[model samples]
Target: MKKPHLIVPEGMEFIRDDIGYAPAVLAGNTLYISGQIGRDDQRQLVVDKEAQFVMVFENMKRVLEAAGGSFENLVEMTSFHTDMRDLPLFMQVRDRYLQGVYVAWTAIGAASLCGAPGYFLEVKGIAQLN
Candidate 1:
């Protein structure tokens, strides 16, 4: 049986230790990532919708790289949003990062997130490592 390895990427802030959950985990060839909010390196929540969207993806990118993968390695993704109407804006920011890289995706509308009040969205995913 393959053991699951907890992945803690350098330079990324994880509240998991203080709270309870890993940012991501590697089990076999798959990397499972937890939901990433638009928190900055200093742990401040980003208020701008577009900026927050970008930050979410950037955080995901960092996690993917730490797990020895890239945006192209992402097989699936799920996004939770406080407002579904921001999908267009979210797509705009997402396209800038992905630049045509395609992956299975899901978007969900939620009333609120765990601890982020001004946060507009959260992104999580699964990546296949090479």
Candidate 2:
């Protein structure tokens, strides 16, 4: 049998989206994390899109940690948003966390996310393990 290339720790999701895909996938020294939405572990859509944006980003951080990686290891990021007008706010909040270790980023205007009204953003990331 082929063993998993990376070991995701307990409490981290073992995502196998039957109808779609997972939050992340690790192969070799590279991790391809799927876009993260603004939902808690219970799948509740956060009340505010921007707040949820931050939350989802934080969630992504946790997922990275569980997989033995750090935010600094991220090489790229992509954000999908329902409203492009909220870019400044998103940038403000996103800037609060990441410093000079800025990764390549792309933001797109989206129609709707996977859930409720306030849940308007999703973030996906790619990281290379050290």
Per-residue accuracy of model 2 over 59-82 as CA lDDT, tens digit each: 788778877888888999999989
TM-score of each: 0.92, 0.85
Q: Please give the lDDT score for candidate 2.
A: 0.77
Clashes of 2: 1
State how far residue 88 of model 1 sits from its true place (Å): 0.3
In model 2, the worst 10-residue window by lDDT is: 1-10
State residue 18's C-alpha deviation in candidate 1, in Å.
5.5
lDDT of 1 by residue, 62-90 (tens): 89988889988888989999999999999
Whole-model lDDT values for every prediction? 0.87, 0.77
